[model samples]
Target chain A: MNPPNIIFIVFDTLRRDICSIYGGDVKTPNIEEFLKDSNIFPRAVSSSPWTVPSHMSFFTGLYAREHGVHEDLEHGDGRVLDKIYEYNGDNIISYLKQKGYLTIGYSTNPWLSPGTGFDRNFSSFTFFSSEYMNLEEMNAVNEYKRYGKNRYEAAKNLILSGNFQEFLKYYRIHKRIIKRKREVGYPFIKGSDLIFDHIMNSSYEEPFFIFINLMESHEPSALWELDIDDRKIKYLDLSGREIISEKKMERTRNGYKRSLEILDFQFGRLIKYLKKMKLYDNTMIIVTSDHGQALKEKRKIPYYGHGNFLYDEIIEVPLIIKFNNNVKINIKNWNQSLVNIPEQIKNSIEGSMDDYMTSEYVFSESFGPVHDFETLIKEGILPSDINFSLMNEKMFYPKKAVYWKNYKLVLNGLTGELDEFTENGKSQDPNEKKEIVENLKEQIYIFKGQESFRV
Target chain B: MTQEIRIEGGLSLNAKVAIAKIVINDAIDRFKRPFVVWSAGKDSMVVLHLVRNVAEERHMDMLPALFIDHGQHYEETIEMLDKISKEWNFKVIYARNEDALSAVKGNKIYLKDLNKENQEEAKKIAQPGEILKDENGEYFEYSLETSVGNHILKTIAMNNAIKRYRIDALFTGIRWDENPARSWEVFISPRENPPHVRVHPILPFTERNIWEYTFKNNLPIHPLYYQGYRSIDGKYDSKKTSDKPAWEQDLEHTKERAGRSQDKEGMMEKLRRFGYM
Candidate 1:
């Protein structure tokens, strides 16, 4: 028998408990139907709380420490391209390509774009902008941010700057975006529909690998003015510059829920098309997330976004796997790390289905703040009084977690101390369960190879 | 090759000592009726001295030390245990499995005459051809060299001691660099079956760190270690790896447990899973 074709989907920033399949409130009816023939891993953890490191783990089956594609104190992605070029030859994409599988990738995340090494071995890779960012929309947002408050002044400033054609075009795009926001109750961010549309239109060879990343459930949640920038929000959230209002959090969270509903409808369309194309039975489909988003969840520190925190809201993600031919497999209640995806795919290709994805120990990692706060301050996105040095020192500690059965141990790399020890999501005193903490800490040390651990 | 535990990689002798003391204080604060597992070796002697310092700080009497007497200990080990406990003004509890020891006849122990616990332990751990049967009953050799003998004689004996005294925690001097199975151990670990915790205050200490602490504190050195044996275990099975003292030998390139029984060391993971320290 031929090897199964693979369809890997990542719902960027999708939380597990929020989905109905994992016993959450959000009604993912399409996901519920998919679960009938799928295995749902309730305790799947992403390797990092943000995009670059988590996606690298998915592609390479190694932790962020191993790949060295992670964020540090002052820079977010300065060395991404260099690291990817250096290590891309040994990843799952190259492995599958060598195995005679035609690999293709589609992503709406800007970080996973073509030049960033995320598209290395793909036969074809495309980055779909979440929102329609034609040259006109870019000018409109830039012009709006430049001009203070009045629309006429912005138009006057643009025309005075010898950009009259650009001014008229920007005005038209600005009006259209506002009208679209009024109609849809949210700003235009590309959803799963764009990827599904492309998939339906394209023709592929047998035994192909399809990778897709959908960004509908990400931030910029509620309806926004065309001038409201994501970088401003990102800076404020990650730097803890401002205490977000509860009302704003509720609005953003509700918008996120609505986005999930839209995503479910779009995903339902893909399942229908796969069945119509007669590829449903022979295709191996996996739907998971890179990481989960935090909606001002109350933690040791209130978490509003991903990247810096190791809280449960940020690391726990949803995992749904539908093996080819709808194989009946036992799903053990073990913590499954996303780093094992590559090996799981290899085992499936070799027709080894006996406890193929079982993991005795799973891990997640985060190295300080993912954004360059200094740049944000210089760009006027944040206030100069943000205490940049203090924030960097406080948030720059490399945090890692090790999960075994029901217990989790979060260790701080800087002080060599236990940050938090929890069982089944409730914090326990480390003094009480020192054995479990030590065991999990040992796993974390081993997972992070000794060379990285020393540094 | 086995991966090295890098927790103690860049730490200085003073920093490692501070961390070990913190672990010891945490064990004292959490567990009542805690006891130190002393083998009269260099590592445990350092732990005992650290515990004495902490006790002096808190103005409370130090806890007793647990010496596992499996009938295979050297006379020097027993003498050190006696002299050190008296000099340090602490008690020493002898944890001996007398039934298993008394069943030894010639080189073999008759399994039928052993206690139910020893018989069950022998049945589980004794390899094929090791347990022989006569017309009377089954029998296995009385030795501490094999995994079965260690589990029955050492682990089972230690577990019975825990049950007898209701020790909430047992502090030991097992270092991460000591054995492959012990590399992943934490400062305080909970074990089951007999229901107690294993407090490893010096897990992050290396061989060199152990010696540095020994000399800095001017603690008593195990006679066998000074006589060239790096690791002093059962008298019959352990041999000297070199003619020089342990600290004088090549510590980094050589394995520390080279003198211990290979049969027991090879199956350390299995032995540990069954509650052996």
Candidate 2:
């Protein structure tokens, strides 16, 4: 039997808090409009803080350690599987290909290009190649580590040697590099054009699986807007400002809201396209984010970018699925992991997706804190309002958080410290929480079989 | 002669018979002191037949059949009960109100053949049921309230008989599609106080399957069912409108308990919840 076409629209770094569907400040009409017919998972979490590892879960149905892609502890080491030498045909890409699906991919992030081993199974793949005008590419130019480890060593020596005049010159050159930055639209307009292009141009004679990774909601968003009143309400316009302050962080918070408006507009357009093509009913459209942004909301971690900590701000992402019918059902299975993305797709094809459950436990993990604890402390990250104890013992611990029933336990590998979040992410009930922590620890031990974890 | 009984758009005659056997062997017969509540209706007769057939095949003990005499059944039904009881050598128990027994004489209706002039005399001798009806009638109110009262009286008698026979589980032939309340009932229902259980073995069957199974097997049922009566309670609480038998009537418009006069008032569920099978 031919499988229904699968379209995975992953909004890179789009957090759960901003989507109005989950009761946030931003009004995402496209997402809300889709919610009328789709199933909304309010508390769906991401596997990782960034695009690379998080998308790996969607493909392999495996966590960080199991899939072997995690935070690059040794940065710029060729040991990283950024580019694949061969297609293994073991992951979701190959799995779907064997099922007779024509696989294609469109990415805006060069890091997600074939060089990063992210696009191996796509029969045809498209990347903008030159649009690195935002933060990631400009920063790559700043460190002089744009794409290679050779320049990284040279740039490290130049910055470490502390030649003030040469450093200023390099900063001037980096400013010039940023000035030439493209992708000024940030995420939405260009993306919608590509989606509509696919729909209008396709013969669509056979079932096809299209994977889209849009990077508009990621950090350093410029020119994003939505009119709330006579005056426009949006994230701060970070045009020429490089210096950081309380003013900048507040604007970044607003930036997330403005980014959501763009996401909603572009997403609505594609949905309209799907309907116009009359493929809305038979097609399976899944919209979710790879992970969320920190926005420095709680001051738990510093900076507006993610990949530093496992706060709800960083891991929680909105998930919505629309297929044929519009009957809304509450699927209360708390154990749905991001790693089961492939399984969800398979079940959708087989007509056996149980909206209520997938397993007893869903997981989220981090190789280490998004930033090394030492860097965070040295960066004056712990605000004066909070205590030192939170970052003291549990700081350096490489952790994995498992959600069970009504409790979430963060298993710290370094100190074996079990950090608990109770119902609605509270931590007050120690007596009841400890027992659950211990049982979940044991379940993990049984699952891994070879290692012992401190409860 | 198999009935293509469409239940929930799925159930067929083979499925109905298979479900009957499974419910009997798996749930009903699992309990000690199990007994069948036979109403001498098509449904109850099928339950009895399934049990007898299971016993013959598996060498299981034959359960005692109990009947609650509400003093309103026809003479032919009472006669068929005696005949079937003797033929199968099945132990039979009768539960009835002691005062009402005297009103019935030798397998005949109580005071039913009286002249219009003698009706007042009969009314004077009539006793009120546990539940009183506002409307006036001879011997009984003949209203839904009276039917509910009679149902309670019958249930009390059945409970007494259950205690006498030490019945732990009572097997019934109620189908889900039969009535509104039964649709929500399960195959095995629990009763707390007496620690008794109600096992409904024919829950998934439809009315057509009941009739077709009986017609094909030539199983004995109430004689009134064939005499233009689809269902039975008594002459006063019944609809004898059609000339054709129950199975012969169009199944769509033919309600299972439409003939039961009290059932028209929709009090059957109340009686059912009160332990009246």
Candidate 3:
């Protein structure tokens, strides 16, 4: 029997609701077409809403609690591996390699780079140059001055310069401030093409396991082409005043949609290429995103975006897997988290068709100092300068509903209150809030009670 | 009767001047064939400035800078190194443990691998005068390759082309206060197998002294330090603040503890779980 070739594609900041297969208005014809033949998990959720931890969970098959690589570490104890239980007694790449598979990974997110330990399980991994982003790079000393003078100015200068090298310098100066935006405009498909070509033409005699990450929807959404008809219109409200000019909004949304379409198109082409090469039949292709994006939609918080909160829009993502002809299981009703992926892969490999369910409740946390109320104020996310001394203080609030067999419970982190919202002019009552608080508190206590996974 | 003189402050003007003169003299003495270890960090920047100053003062030929690229350094570090190299017109050479880094890149090696490999190799590469075997035929040697003959040979081969052309002495800017391990390093030491001598011109200096000197001398340091980072260890910290005490904000000690030998097994376990091992 031929070893399965695996293809893992991650779309950065891609919201599940926007995809056509996920019941959105987005014109993802290629994706919709592909999903028809593939196994799509409509209720797939992410371990974390943010990129780093989410990707960690996906690859390691452990919740953030088990791994402990929660936020960026300036000088991490470098003991990240000790916290992880050898899901299969080895990493995914090592396991696959032992099975005679050639591993390759390409990501536009720098966090996925080897510096952050994400490159560990892959034979080859490449990250988009952070130099392309218009941000000040933080040096060791500047990292000392977390929120220093001219921080934004330095970042803006780098952006304005448009020179990759200069941008790298600025990026070092203000890494904390510009990390997200710097991740926004990566050319995902183009970068992956380089790896794909190498894999196709290389003389290496091994089945391939390829991973690709696309960063189009991250931030400063800059992928739309101005020529599309859907993006060319201009609009005005009933007052004849422009809430958002039709042409501009169309241009922005169209650009983002066009990029998604391009991703889908490329994915289809890659699959076809693999099929033509006779590698598709044995390949188990899985499509997933680290996390979903916030498209300026109203959530518990009146605003739309990831970070500071883990709402459905941020935590829920699209997961699709196509496993040649061995199995025909449609896991439509099964809600799973990214952490369940590795075990699922193992079970699938062993030909286990039993109803394998993910844990009922998964947890995540972010401890970066930038999440303080002051930074939010600077970013204009909050109403005023709120005392953020309580930001570091962990507060747990239970979710309104635990989806997928009551196994999965959502707990609100630091910004839980800000995300509280009213639906149709009616706010949730004290009882609803109390239930959420209780569930969240229980999860927190459970996390605290567990022996520190520190080796 | 002669009046006894009393200095108004902790250090007298003469004492300060004498100390400055001694520092300048030591810098000049070391600059003759200085091989500056340029990490593009704060201390290295000061070292480079001191070397340049010494060269200018004595009208001696400047030495080339040496950079050991671990391949995972921040982009800013590379850029600053390039800029400083070009601005100062100093020859720059970057040496990398490609095998180790590639192993790291391929997930075959990790931070623990470094310590493990170093420990194993340490037992095999004993110094010339040191006892390498016991009477019962048990073999023993130095605990680190940093002082090994083969490592010295490799370093010479890797660095000789540039160092032979210019350097006679390797000038390192390591300060005693950076880490407990560095506290015992002497001001000067002879190379194990090479002809060149190792000099720590800034051995007596504290972190504050280095900062004061760099500030007074207007040296170009890697800008990350100004942002809030206190160490050269490649890690990310998002909450560093300039106004706060470094110890209060910096995670260097915590991070260092993660890599210590006392926690070796634990660190290895963490590395394994993260798939780094």
User: Which candidate achieves the best lDDT against the true structure?
Assistant: 1
Question: Which has the better lDDT: candidate 1, or candidate 2?
Answer: 1
User: Considering chain A alone, what is the TM-score of candidate 1?
Assistant: 0.90
Please identify which of the two predictions, 1 or 3, would achieve the higher TM-score against the true structure: 1
Place model 3 in a CAPRI quality band: incorrect
| iRMSD value for model 1 | 16.7
Rank by TM-score (best first): 1, 2, 3
Cα RMSD to the true fold for all candidates: 12.0, 21.3, 23.0
- Once model 3 is optimally superposed onto the true structure by TM-score, how far is the C-alpha of residue B161 displaced, in angstroms? 64
**What TM-score fits each model?**
0.63, 0.51, 0.46
TM-score of 3: 0.46
Error of 1 at A280 (Å): 1.4
Give stretches of model 2 more than 4 Å off: A72-78, A82-89, A129-183, A186-205, A222-244, A299-303, A324-330, A369-395, A447-453, B1-277
Could you tell me which 10 consecutive residues in candidate 2 chain B have the lowest summed lDDT?
A: B130-139
TM-score of chain B of 3: 0.60
Candidate order by lDDT, highest to lowest? 1, 2, 3
Runs off by more than 4 Å, candidate 3: A72-90, A130-204, A223-254, A330-332, A353-455, B1-277
For A1-455, candidate 2 gives per-residue lDDT tens digits of 45678888888888887788888889877777788888877568787776767887788776665565666433312334542332242688888888888888877666577667887878877775334445654565546543223333445667778655655655576565545543344323335445545656765545788888877777655332221110111111111122245565676667667777876887787788778877777777888889888664543334456663677777878888875444365677565567778877877777755563234666677755433323332333322333335433334445667666766666665566655455667765556666776676744433321122333
